[model samples]
Target: MGDLGLFGPGSVTWKVHAEPILMVAGLRALLLQTLHPRALAGVVQNSDFRVRPWHRLETTVTYVVTVNYGTTADAEEAGRKVRYIHSRLRGVDPRTGEEFRLDDPDLLRWVHVVEQESFLDVARRSGVKLTDAEADEYYREQLRAAELVGLDPATVPSSRAEVAEYYESMQPELATTRDTVESMLFMAVPPMPFGLGWTPLRGAYTGVAALALSMLPTWARQRYGLPGLAVADPAASMAARILRAGIMPIPRRLIEGPIYKAAMARARAAGHAI
Candidate 1:
């Protein structure tokens, strides 16, 4: 049998992922993701985030939303497109002087784990409650996305404990590199297209960037020479609440974009209430 789109409205993936705070979580994920030098190289070599940051942002968010919310066929097809893109890309590891494919499983796993952990970390800090079991379930269910990117689901971490262990095992491979700094700066303030540098827009972007940075794991922050302090925890929590409140009033149909709209349509067709 094939996969069902949306994993149904009841899937743990939907429960945690449907929240708006995930947009901020995406920034945190970007920061964590660039810490893996090889992965950073893949991005720096292949992506144009520096020149067209919003395009990169939109593409990242679109792929994620597709994998998590698209129909099984659509999700699989999306995965195939990503795999095809990766298959064509190669990069040299600056640290090791070795060449690598973008689709390398180890690198893929690093990308996968950091993205997952970042989303969960930010959502939980922002007050979307998931019991330990629910959190574990969300992790387990998220393996589909990993598989879509050609990762071996069996080798991927699928629970909170497993995720913790996975990160521990990979610590030796993580670091701060030039690419990491560049990627983080781009993610933090991005760049204003067309010279529109209004104070309110710039201030809000900086605030969100600070919030994302504040949510980083201490070791990750220390690697970047950033201080991840205790005070940031409560501050992040308050900011999270504010963000949640801001997005909560908007209808889901308005904020979630096309992939989500299609997913909700599928859910409705299946007689499921979204």
Candidate 2:
């Protein structure tokens, strides 16, 4: 019965995102984002992402979890923090002489759409049960998320068909740049930090990244010059389930972060059994 933030327990956003496989979706989003030259250029110019990739990822995850499960005030504050950062970032196109703001509506919209698409695709492919209507509802709910990062809500696609159409329309604008190729390779095997690069765990992480790559839509795979395997979707889904099951033995408290723990307390106080 307390404030449930931008999206409550009742929202499809909560339902779809509860899956641990969202970890893969995060990588997939990064892969998809690099396909856009402007977006990639903006990041290459303005971000310290290459040197501190894990730090950048943690920042992104913190904002997403706060928005998804924090109280109203907390969520708004998180959004404000992100918007302010975006407003300060600018980059010049490597291919053209043009300069661009990181928060240019066009760039914002592109990032929002690919990101949400990656979430839904990974969730469904990873064995989350969502009806067509529920899938549509998820996108509808994510429009609020799009708005959080400075996108116009009305400009974003709010259903599967619309998203597909949007992708189709944007295809001509998407091509692999040299930076894109480098980014893909970087993601495939991001160097480990703190001397962990020499550990066997680094090989395990590469296997996880491969599953994320396999789950990309055929068109996206094709764009990257990878084989567009008709069977990759199902194969990735199977792999996701196996991976999810393997992690399930870890006690919930051992892995759930402070944000998740706090959110669950709030939900319990509201009388939700979960």
Candidate 3:
């Protein structure tokens, strides 16, 4: 799952490339939550408005799990652990700022769905190549975990159209005030500290590859003196660049604000709400 580029556009290898690093990060988060639910709860409940500590924590954990253990079974287990910890935490209501249950159904659903989507998108982008049968299997496996989180299995969308509809129906419930989904998107990519263990070599390679790819067209134009060559075969050139450069890492911040907003806008234009 970590190998999947669902996070954003990059080399397919980078998606696979970043998995182990992400997995380690996830394991760290889960271990922290398991050991210190109260501290985690406190962070979730009282962090400053600008800093969403809980969201970051969740993202870290999810990335770790997805990268380390890509199977549905692993995701389900991770979900269960999150729910368990959430059940124990006491927090102020997000909307009302009053004492509230961390295990609130709505909140749980939001978290679970966001994480699930991240993993799914990664899988899709990485060219995991899920056939309808595989998709159905994936859906069924996820359904069991969704049930644990209080989500209705029936609510899970199986087809692209259904996914669009699901996003539409949840639009009202989704926060639009501060691009909450964007936060999820950005956070889904774990920070370096958390990701260091899984694929350090791959991570380094991807970063270098991305940097090289970014400079290739200019290099080609300047060195080879081939004006418009890059433009003429942009797609092929980009592909060649990635192949030559190796895997590249995309920064999470790039995906959150503008990119996410654009996606949301497009989805909305297509009659799907985010």
Candidate 4:
């Protein structure tokens, strides 16, 4: 009926991304990204995430929301800004002194792959019922997300098996750095606003963060020296499901971003049942 961004209302990407569990999925992706030394080095050198973590988080949330739920024009504009920033930023690997561009296809592809995997994995784990075929379709549909960030969609994995192979291929290149440790530690205990750390809200945040960490692969968890308890997996899933159950029913206008609202209104105006 109308433009519904890269993945429309009926698409799997929209369905998976709309869930509240993606907040944790995003954290999981961040944790996984740090396992790549080049990725960690690039971020440490280029981003101000350390000093203004909340701002960084806000910027990222806005980008994600806009790209996934905004109109095609808005999403493309967002991508242009991201690509411009990546094109201008340069950094060197702390471990090898090897220089890298933020827009490096390999780095961008790695980020895209891990991010999509995190979203899909967390959604399924949190009781979003997706069959294997639908899961693969989800990955296939997400190629547009990769393309939005300036990557050639052909370079990105388009299936679950391809994603696994991509990870396996990357394993030889992944490693830990001091920056990685600091990043993960920050994830574990990011600075709280004024007095928010003293309430049950803090524990709720911790549960989400721990759930994110628990979903990391054992090897990656071991690389970061974060405990990979066998029991944590099921517990994390339960926590995620509970959070999703509680959050998904909230009024959409209160929870969704303005761009999401606009797009949905457009779809509705076009006589779509979304």
| Tens-digit lDDT string for candidate 1 (57-146) | 888888898888887888899999999999999999999889999999998888998999888888888889888898888888888889
What's the number of clashes in each of the models?
0, 1, 10, 0
Please identify which of the two predictions, 1 or 2, would achieve the higher lDDT against the true structure: 2
lDDT of each: 0.84, 0.87, 0.42, 0.86
Supply the TM-score for candidate 4.
Answer: 0.94
Q: Give the clashing residue pairs of candidate 3, or none.
A: 3-15, 3-16, 6-121, 6-122, 20-198, 21-198, 21-199, 22-64, 26-64, 206-247
If both were scored by TM-score, which would come out higher, candidate 1 or candidate 2?
A: 2
Residue pairs in candidate 2 whose N, alpha carbon or C atoms collide under 3 angstroms: 1-270
**Could you tell me the lDDT of residue 135 within candidate 4?**
97
What TM-score does structure 1 among the candidates reach?
0.93
lDDT string, candidate 2, 46-70, tens digits: 8888899888988999888888878
- Lowest summed-lDDT stretch of 10 residues in model 1? 1-10
- Return the candidate ranking by lDDT, descending: 2, 4, 1, 3
| Model 2 ranges with Cα > 4 A deviation | none
TM-score for each of the candidates: 0.93, 0.96, 0.44, 0.94
The alpha-carbon root-mean-square deviation between model 1 and the true structure, to one decimal in Å, is 2.1
Of the two candidates 2 and 3, the one with more favorable lDDT, higher being better, is 2
Strongest candidate by lDDT: 2
Structure candidate 1, residue pairs in collision: none
